[model samples]
Target: MEYKIYVQNLKCGGCAKTITNKLNGIKGVSNLNIYVEDSLVILNCTEIILEKVKETLKKAGYPEDGEQNSLSSKAKSYVSCAIGNIG
Candidate 1:
């Protein structure tokens, strides 16, 4: 299965390596792709373990979810508020 995680505060190679090491140790995780620009981590795993994933991400100095990308958040809010408006 493919697992998508939203990550925050990834700034450099060290941050990437840290998260990679923690996740690579997981038995069911086949692959992990981190997209820093969007603060997202795409995981290929047999099992989707959200709690452990969140914990590991926290230990790696990054947190998954509950945070939004600035531009995306603004766009979403705009779209939500614009719904049903008579233009």
Candidate 2:
């Protein structure tokens, strides 16, 4: 199955990298694609694995579609981007 998740605070390549790293860690995810401009994450996986992906994204500071991002959340994304760039 394929899932499309719109993640808030997904602003740059750094955010995409972070999301990719975390999601790739999951056992069943495959064909993962992160669209930074659209804030969309596309992937192939089972329904059960889909929930795990959503939870993982939320924990990683990129909440799934429908969730509002706070100012702090946006700030955190920038910080994450900076760290990702450095490392």
Candidate 3:
């Protein structure tokens, strides 16, 4: 199945690569797409890996598009924090 996730903080191709790699690591995920301009991520995977995808992103320095900032401008900054250490 395909799941559309609101993932903010994808600043550049490097950031997108990080997200893609992390999400693709999940066993249930077949593909991943990130839209930096729209601040969204489309995940192609099974329900079984939904939580895993979130966790992976969390660990990768990008939340599922909603967090402390909650704004497009601050998304990348927050994502950097999340990726840096989550501290």
Best by TM-score: 2
TM-score versus the correct structure, for each prediction: 0.65, 0.87, 0.69
TM for candidate 3 is 0.69
Tell me the TM-score of model 1. Answer: 0.65
- Model 3 residue runs over 4 Å out of place are 68-87
The local lDDT score (0 to 100) that residue 45 gets in candidate 3 is: 75
lDDT of 2 by residue, 1-87 (tens): 988999898888888888888889999999999999999999999999999999888777788878766676677778777776666
Q: Tell me the number of clashing residue pairs for each predicted model.
A: 0, 0, 2
Total clashes for model 3: 2
- What value of lDDT does candidate 2 attain over all alpha carbons? 0.86
lDDT of 2 at 4: 91
Worst 10 residues of 2 by lDDT: 68-77
* Candidate rank order under TM-score: 2, 3, 1
Q: Rate the local accuracy (lDDT) of all candidates.
A: 0.63, 0.86, 0.67
Q: For residues 1-87, write the lDDT of model 1, one tens digit per residue.
A: 888887766654555665676788877776788776776788876554756777677654565567434654444333432431322
Output candidate 1 Cα RMSD: 13.3
lDDT of 3 at 25: 70
By summed lDDT, which 10 consecutive residues of candidate 3 come out lowest? Answer: 78-87
